[model samples]
Target: MIDNSVRTLFLLKHSPYPPMGGAPLRNWQNIKAMMQLGEVAVFSVSSYKSPRSREYPPGVSLWKDYSTGDILKERSLIRKISDRLWWMRLYGYPEADQFYGDRVAQELQRLLVEFAPNIVVFEEIWLYRYLKIIKPYGCCLIYDAHNIEKSLRRDISVSEHKPPFVSSLSGIKTAIIEGYLVQQVDQIWVCSQQEAHLLQKLYRQIPPTHIVANGVNIADYHSDRISHSLPTDGLEPNHFTAIFTATFSYYPNSVAAQILIGQIYPQLRKFYPNCRLILAGHSPTPYMKESAQEDSGIIVTGKASDIRPYLTAASVVIVPLLKGGGTRLKILEAFAAHRPVVSTTKGAEGLNVRDGEHLLIRDKVEDIVAGVCQLWSDSSLGRKLAESAYKLVQQEYSSTAVRQQVEQAVLQLLPSDFRF
Candidate 1:
């Protein structure tokens, strides 16, 4: 029995499940949160995860693509050619995912025709190829610009080993297509004002955008206690403890680690001789694994199935990101877990965080050393910063507050007052 009083929202994304990457994680959580507001019909490309693993909320209906099994596999020749053609649209050229058409396109067509949702929410512009089929329905379109897609690619190309000309070409082409895509959607949602403003600054004519910073589930994070697996190697007596949340898989995280381990950690050790830097995340790359094995004061846990132990064990959390976009979920987790943080301007790039009040921020290594030492030497200051951080998370980034903003946005998109 369908409820005529409830509005229907079609939420679509490039992936069906969460926990694989940052964007998908935020999108999945937002979808679950949105369901609490109204009935939702989700359409996504499931080529990345097993369909059985996808958890769809009770009131949210779902539609997915079965065209491609897993995006990590090899494809047929013609299919590969088609993917290459599609990839050039936003990415500006060929890449792995480009060699295959996201199954979301086919499934989106099916969903729009059958379900006819009142509002259609897209997780990323990469799924624009499917818009041609659903646009005629005239439903409100909410485009969640995960990042200024082109700006992210431009930053990524800097660290890439590709030829200079190739990088430039890709950057130019991506900018053009993404600029056009920005104009097509009715409204946009982003993880942070930094990201939302970046898109607005880039296109200069983007639709109304909102900053929906990622929220932490304080209860879920507190459920687990912090523990350490590092053998009490003689270096364990460090007075200053710092932890970084990241995986070697992402360029920004890897680049931050390169600097933190290669540069900042070394500098901090001089001031606090026993300073211990803990790096924990999923999939430690080959380079990361080798670096971890080195006799340096850095302790690297390649892939911790649980990061709560690492977060809990630390006196301070550092988000020394050198590049990239979106809100830093790691910083929020650190704050909610009651750990003080020291981040570069880019590390604390988004959200309504206040420097020194919520978390400390420094750009230069000298400043980073000073910030860490200042917090490390004074237990009262460290405890005060930790308390302030937890309060900041509670005040603004709470799920309740964020959900209010999301519900308001969704309600505005609805054609009339309706309930689910």
Candidate 2:
């Protein structure tokens, strides 16, 4: 007989609270959904350790915070060097912030015995190594593939024009690891059907997969409707403000910011001098800060406590991402906020939104500029698009719709007689 009160342990690299990007927002929403089904606890490493670290999700039964330093100290000098080299060569990121292995395994072992969770959900592939520890416990393992990481890296390699030799080696290693993990996990959760199909082609032994597209917390956005508050600082009164929000640390988003200020803004300025561009998100690269300082019309809000104020203030939101995997949560947020969006075709890739009805989709610089200009010039058109997008989000991408999918998927993995 299946247990009615099932328990889950969710593992992620970073705390899902204070979500600033697409992936974190998904993590946050997924965790919220998990709580409604049964008891839930989170295991995560601190991105930055502090005495004043805030509690996430408020009333979770357990929240364990591990340190990267603990993991590093357990490795030999040569091993550390080798790992550093591998990370740099594979992901082009030298920092070992997201790496977890044997050092974490011991703590994980203790947690597993104490929690005795029936289900263990990993946030992404990087946490796949933990499966070794999880397997002996016989807990059902779910690998939430945020995107086909191997393919995403390959795209990044090609986009950044990495050396052919380096790209080939990285691609081979990534594929081998990802393929191995796909075979090991009991279930694989993907964000889109396209990603699921792609993974199946890439890995012949792929496990049963489910599509759980990222959703917006409609309440988070709707709260804005009730509150007419705007940020006291960092926002200037502009006649027409076109805003783009993305975590600046990501290469694609950083490139998009550059494109916005460099390529698109020039064309846009020719027609509307009073218009301004706002790039808001965490970790503003030095180049972005420098570019913003150089151009008076561009405002870079490095990071903000809340994004709704910016969204509420935007005349139009733009998603000019050139390349990335998975659906864009930013678009969903725009829709929830009832803000008209102008995005590149790639930006709206996995969303079930119509271009003309929900948001405008444009690819080239000229077309992107035209879309934003059209929205700014035509308030009625913007209102229609925003209203349509909001309705679509309410019916499709709302937390209620997505949480049900998650609940069914979780139940399917549980014992046959499992009750709510």
Candidate 3:
């Protein structure tokens, strides 16, 4: 029998809203779908604000806040280290700030006693500290691990200096604590198999982890939409265009940008005279900004209210990302729009894509140039790749697959007596 009673669910995250990458988008989309089942309360944090953050579904309840400015500005070594220790206690590694200060932890304890939930989904591992507050309430706990945090951390450690190793004592301590957190979750909802395998090898001996690849919101990422608001620093669709968008400040993104502009783009332009690569994202540094100025072929547009215009206009969407974990939602977004992709093997690591069938893969700069030239010269090939990519998303990576996974994960975790 199905129970339609409004079963409350609590969601927690290490970061705040209007999700950028896979984690936040999944968070947002999950919340929207779960509301159809019953009532939901999202306990989340964000350091920044945007108009989009305020846009929540009709019945969705929120316990989210803007990240603390004071928490971010703490520069004193003694205090920072102290906060990190305190923060890491909450998770394995400390986030910017703890969600429940001394009072809130007590408040959550009190609330659990009051509005008991059927399920509780922790958006990231950091909030797993609240497990005690949750588990005792007899509610299901779903750890929506956006990525396998520990392995992803290790990958970042070597790929670039961003997620650098913690050094001797701290590194050992971090690994020990992180491994334990994954073990406690009732069910871990992971993004990719590569990440799941890394976690299972590190911690679990049995019981398979769930693989829920991130999805693209094909409805919002529409075609034929141009932003009249954008200043349009003289961009045209007529040229042979290549587009990539991400929070460029990210480690893999910065690394990929440097390599693409520094090495690959030059060779790409040599063969195809009219080609231009657009670096479209938020907060592009001075070096990235200059790439467009120096090369008429390379245009860097810093932040767009709606990136669909750039995606819709481009002939190719290139993801040269060399580091990171989980499916590149950026690639999925482009694929959703039927844009042909040219990526490094590492960039297209997990999304269940083919080398030459769904996408054209290249590790060498010369090969990258050849791939681009091939797409540029052959209009038929570009359309074929684009059509094939879109079909891939529709068949396997749709929002329907994502929402169904959440439903089953929640059902498996919840107590049988609980109604939803």
| Candidate achieving the largest TM-score | 2
Badly placed stretches (over 4 Å) of model 3 are 1-17, 48-59, 70-81, 84-92, 96-100, 103-115, 162-174, 206-208, 224-231, 416-420
Q: TM-score per candidate, in order?
A: 0.84, 0.92, 0.85
Q: Model 2 Cα displacement at 403 (Å)?
A: 0.6
Ranking by TM-score: 2, 3, 1
**Would you give me the overall lDDT of model 3?**
0.68
Clash-forming residue pairs, model 2: none
Expressed as tens digits, the lDDT of each residue in 286-377 for candidate 1 is: 66667767846678876555677667667888888877775477888888888888899888877677887888899888888788888888
Per-candidate alpha-carbon RMSD to the true structure: 4.0, 2.9, 3.8
Q: Can you list the residue pairs that collide in candidate 1?
A: 83-98, 226-309, 238-274
User: Which 10-residue window of candidate 1 scores lowest in summed lDDT?
Assistant: 45-54
Candidate 2: tens digits of C-alpha lDDT, residues 57-169: 66466777676666767777866676767744543332333456576778888888888888888877666667778899898888888889788878778777678887777
- The lDDT-based order of candidates, best leading, equals 2, 1, 3
Tell me, by lDDT, which candidate is best. 2
TM for candidate 1 is: 0.84
